[model samples]
Target: MRTFVAGQEAVDETEFVELALGIDVDLFRGPLEKETAEERRARRDVAREVLRELRESAEAGDEVAGWDALYADALMRTVPFVRAARGQRAGTGVAA
Candidate 1:
């Protein structure tokens, strides 16, 4: 949860570059890139709708469902695209 700014003793060039570019170097451990302005607005709208549904479900005493598995599956389906994007971004000669 802690971030090191440029020029910090513990920070290195790769970390600085990642910070500047808004990309994560440690893909397995770092946070995803922040959403764009349009994405933020769209997500806010979706969140409002989800919240309304949750409130309605709560009032009806219905169980609130978690979409963890669905989201995991969706992510799994997008793995190839993600890998391609990462490879393109990194300029690595790997084919996806």
Candidate 2:
């Protein structure tokens, strides 16, 4: 894909954000493309871990600047897509 900026052509980078949000990874498969129990469990695990770490850091009075710095560093090395192994039945279509 391509985009124009100031009348100059540029590579379109919109997909990167979707990858960061894991939208580019297909977590569901099989003939029906339905999410399975294992996928739901793994998502729950990740959510719990993230929440636990955030709560712990907040309770410890960690400085937001410090956390932001670390997060930024991690983002710098972020992969386009990080997904579970293939052939694993996963994904829960849950919403916030």
Candidate 3:
């Protein structure tokens, strides 16, 4: 681990060593578990449903009124999983 301090502030060697040791301890922690199959399926289903609704609305011209009707719909559907994955990645320092 690298320690960075403002130019005006100086850290002693012992403090720097402690900081590096802490970082090393954290780095060796186990990776996070992947999402379960059920969770993946559920999220996919939600995204599919949202896409279907968007398609229907577009077909019916309901989306023609400058409506952001489907705005972020797909993203919203996957937000939970995305957030979980992000948390896992950040915590474990591993890609999900």
Candidate 4:
């Protein structure tokens, strides 16, 4: 049996597997195609850990003069995404 995947773009692992495995396309679905609930949870957990460290470092006050602002901005951006991830399954866009 012959299989064809059409595109001028570079084929990634997912497309390669699809062609090789006889097109069980779902064999490779992750942060690229769809973000699963487990993936979301893991991402959120890592964010939480990073935030914790950021808070600690900010309290320490030994970094540059603008790191606090960056941390705050990251927190603000992360909040909404984390909240969205908390909702139903993420069959959505690239991010949350």
**How many pairs collide in each candidate, listed in order?**
0, 2, 0, 0
Report the number of the highest-TM-score candidate.
Answer: 4
Please provide, for model 4 over 1-96, each residue's C-alpha lDDT reduced to its tens digit, 9 standing for 90 to 100: 334555423257656654443322222122334455687577556655555665576677846313643544444343244435655334454565
- Please list the C-alpha lDDT of all candidates, in the order they appear: 0.44, 0.42, 0.43, 0.46
Clashing pairs in 4: none
Q: What is the TM-score of each candidate against the true structure?
A: 0.33, 0.32, 0.34, 0.37
Report the lDDT tens digits of candidate 3 across residue range 49-68: 65566567777886531132
RMSD to native, candidate 1: 15.0
lDDT of 2 by residue, 1-96 (tens): 655554555444544433343322222111224345686567545544554565477567866634543553354333323233333323323531
Candidates ranked by TM-score:
4, 3, 1, 2
Which residue pairs does candidate 1 place in steric collision?
none
- 82 in model 2: Cα distance from truth in Å? 23
Candidate 1: where is the Cα deviation over 4 Å? 1-31, 65-96
Candidate 3 C-alpha error for residue 16, in Å: 47
Selected candidate, larger TM-score, 3 vs 4: 4
lDDT-best of 2 and 3: 3
